[model samples]
Target: MLELNFIRANKSRVIQGLKIKNFSEEDLQIVEEILSLDDTRKEVQTELDSLLAERNQLSKTIGDLMKAGKRAEAESQRERVGQLKEQAAKLEDSLKDTKVQLEELLLKVPNIPHESVPPGATPEDNEVYKAWASPLPELSSDALPHWELAQKYNIFDLELGVKLTGSGFPVYRGKGAKLERALISFFLDEATRAGFEEVIPPLMVNEDTARATGQLPDKEGQMYYVERDNLYLIPTAEVPVTNIYRDVILDAADFPVKMTAYTPCFRREAGSYGAHVRGLNRVHQFDKVEIVVLQHPDKSYETLQEMLAHVSGLLDKLELPYRILRLCGGDMSFTSALTFDFEVFSAAQKRWLEVSSVSNFETYQSNRMKLRFRDGKATRLAHTLNGSALALARVVAALLENNQTPEGIVIPKVLRDYTGFELLN
Candidate 1:
C-alpha cells in the first residue's frame, strides 16, 4: 500500500503515474475518493481528540468540585463530561469508518512506476533489455510441440490428471517426474549457493499473508481458496516466504535478507483458455522455486541487478536461448515498481515462454506487511523483491521443445548429475 502522506503530498505525480499504468477513469476516481475520505478522517479524528480532551478536563474539574463538597456543581460537570464522551464515541466510530473506506480505496491503487519505467499501455510496448546473441533455433516441421513430445515420450499424463482432479492439473510420470524434481533441486541449490537461506513454507496461507504480499484483493479470483479452512492455496512461494517478515523489525545491519523456497503453486487460472495454454505452457498447479529479498531502500536496485544476473546465469548454464524484457508501466504488476521478465525461446513452439519475473516492489509490499528496519533512531519500510528462480512448467516446455530430436529429448549437461540420465526418451 502507498503511504497516505506520500499520496497526499504528491497527488498530481501519483495521478500521472496511474495514468501511465493505464488506470481507467473509475480507477482514478478511487484515488480521489481515498483523498476525500482521508480528509474526513482527519476532521473526525481532530474533533474526537478535542472532545476527549474536554471530557478529561471536565472529569478533573468534577473531582475538584466533589472534594470541595459542591455536589450540585460536580453533578453538572459530570453531565457535561458524559455528553462529551458520547460525542467522542460517535466521532471515533466515524473516524474508524472513514479510515476503513480510505484503506480499501488505497488497496485499489497500484504502486507507482519507478521513474525509469517506460510509459506504455501493453506488453507490445515493453522494451527488450537484452537478447542472447546466439541465433534462435530453427526446427523442421517434423519437430513436435512439447505436448506432442510429452505423449510420444510417455512423460506427463494430462488425461490421468483430469481423472484424478480436473483439467489444467497434470501428472508427471517416470522421467517427467524425475525431470521436475531435478529442476526443483537445481533451482534450490543455485539459490542456496547465491547466499539465500532455503525455506519450506506452508502451501496454504491465511488472508493476512496473502494480502501482505499483494496477492489478495487483486488476485482473489486467481487463487484457490479453501472455504472450509478459510485459507488460500498459495499461488507462489513468494507469498509465504516474504510474509515471514511481516510485522518484523530488523536492524540496519540486516541490510539484505535473502531467502528462497520451492513449493507446488496452485492457481485457479479462471477463464483462461486458448491454444497457447496447452500442455506445460499454462497450468492450474505447478512447481516453482522463488527467491525473495528484504533490502535497504537505497541498495534494492543494485540487489535487483544482482538477482537478474543470478537468473541469467542459470539460463546460460542450461544453454537455452532467452531474452530479457523491461516491462512497461501498463505491463507491470500491481505490486511491482519495476519488473524484468525472462522468456526462453521454445524452438518447436516457435514462441517465447516467460519463465521468470524479477521485480523490486520498493516499499509497496513492506508497507502493507509492516516490515520495517530501524535506521539508527528512525524506522522505515524495507524494500521487498521476489523472482521465480524459474517456474518449472514453462521451463520444462522450453527445454523439451528446444532439445527435442527425432530420436530422443536431450537433457542439459548441467542437470545430468541430478537427473542421472542424459535423455528423457
Candidate 2:
C-alpha cells in the first residue's frame, strides 16, 4: 500500500500518475475523498482528546472543591465533566466512522506509476525494454505446436492430466519429466550462484502468507483453497518465499537479502480459454524457480535492474530469443509499482509466450507484511522484489517448440549437462 501520508500530501501527483496508468477520473476523486476523510478523522480525534483533557482537569477541581466543603461548586463541576464525557464519546464514534471511510477508499486506490513508465492502457502499448542474444528463429507454416510435438515425443499427456485433475494440468513422462526436473535444478543452481539463498518453501500457505503477498483480498478467486484447512495452495513461490520476512525487523547490516526457491504453484484459472491456454502457456499447476530480494529503500530500483540482468543472462545462456517488456499501469499488479515481463519465442507456435515477470513492489508488500529494517536513525520499510528465474513448464514448452528440427529436439547447450542429453526424439 502507498503511504497514507504520501497519498495525502501528493494527491495531485498520485492522480496524474494514475492517469498515466489509465485509472478512471472517478478513482482520482476517491483518493481525494480519502484525504478529506483523513482530515475529518484527525479533527474528531483532536476534539475528543481536548474534551478528555478538560474532563480530567475538572475532576481534580471537583475533588479540591469537595475537600474545601464547597458542595455546590463540586456538583456544578461534576455536571460539566459528565457533559464533556458525552461529547467525547460522540467524537470517538465519528472518528471511528471516518477511519473506516479512509480505509475503504485507500484499498481501492492503485499505486502511483513511476515517471519512467510509458503512458498506455495495455501490453500492446508497452515499450520493449531490450532483446537478448539475437533475432528470433524462423518457423515454417507447418511447424508443429508444442502440444502436437508433445504427443509425437510421448512426453506430455494432456488427456491423462485431465483425467487425474483438470484441463490446465498436463502430465509429463520419461525425458519430459526429467527435463522439467533438470530445469528446476538448473534455475536453482544459477540463482544460488548469483548470491541468492535457495529455499524449499511450503506449497500451501496460511491466510496470513497470502495477505502478505497481496493475493488474499483482491485475488482470492485466482488461487486454489484447501477448504477443510482454510489454507491456500500457493499461486507462486513468491507467496511463501517472500512472507518469510514478514514481521521482521533487520539491522542495516542486512541491507540486501536475496533468496530463491523452487516450488510447484497452483492456480485456479477459473475462467480462461482459447489459444492462450494452449500447451504450457497457462496451467493449473506448474513448477518454477523464483528469486525474491529485500533491499534498502534507496537501493531498490537498482536491485530491480540487477535482477533483470540476471534473468537476461540466463536467457542468453540458453540462446533463446526473448524480450523484456515494461508493463503499463493498467496491466501492473495491485502490489507492484513496476513490472517487467520476459517473453520467449516459441518457433513452432510462431508466437511469444510469457516465461517470467520480475517486479519491484517497492514497499507495497513490506508495508502489508510489516517487514522493516532498523537503520539506527529510523525504522524504515524495506523494498521488496520478486521474479521468476524461469517457470519450468513454459520454458520447456518454448524449448520443445523452438528446438524442433527434423532430426530431433536439440536441447540448449547450457541445459544439456543438466538434462544429460543433446536431443530428445
Query: Model 2, which residues run further than 4 Å from truth?
Result: 49-93
- Of candidate 1, the 10-residue stretch with the lowest lDDT total is 23-32
Candidate 1: what lDDT? 0.92
Candidate 1 deviant stretches above 4 angstroms: 24-32, 58-74
TM-score of decoy 2: 0.90
- What are the per-residue Cα lDDT tens digits for candidate 2 across 1-425? 77788887887898898788777777568777877788788888888888988998999999999999999989988988889988888888888888877766766766677777887877788888886557678877777888998999988888899999889888999889878888888899999899999999899999999987789777999998989999999999999999999999999789789999999989898878888788888889999999999999889899999999999898888878899999877788877888999999988777888999999888888888899999888898899999999888888888888888888788898888898998998
Best by TM-score, which number?
1
The CA-based lDDT of model 2 is what? 0.87
Candidate 1 residue-wise lDDT, 1-425, digit = tens: 99898888999889988988998777788777888888888888888888888888888888898899999989888878878878888888888888888888899899999888998989999999998788899998899999999999988988899999999899999999999999999999999999999999999999999999999899999999999999999999999999999999999898799999999999898887899899988999999999999999999999999999999999999989999999999899999999999999999989999999999999999999999999888899999999999999999999999999877889999999999999888
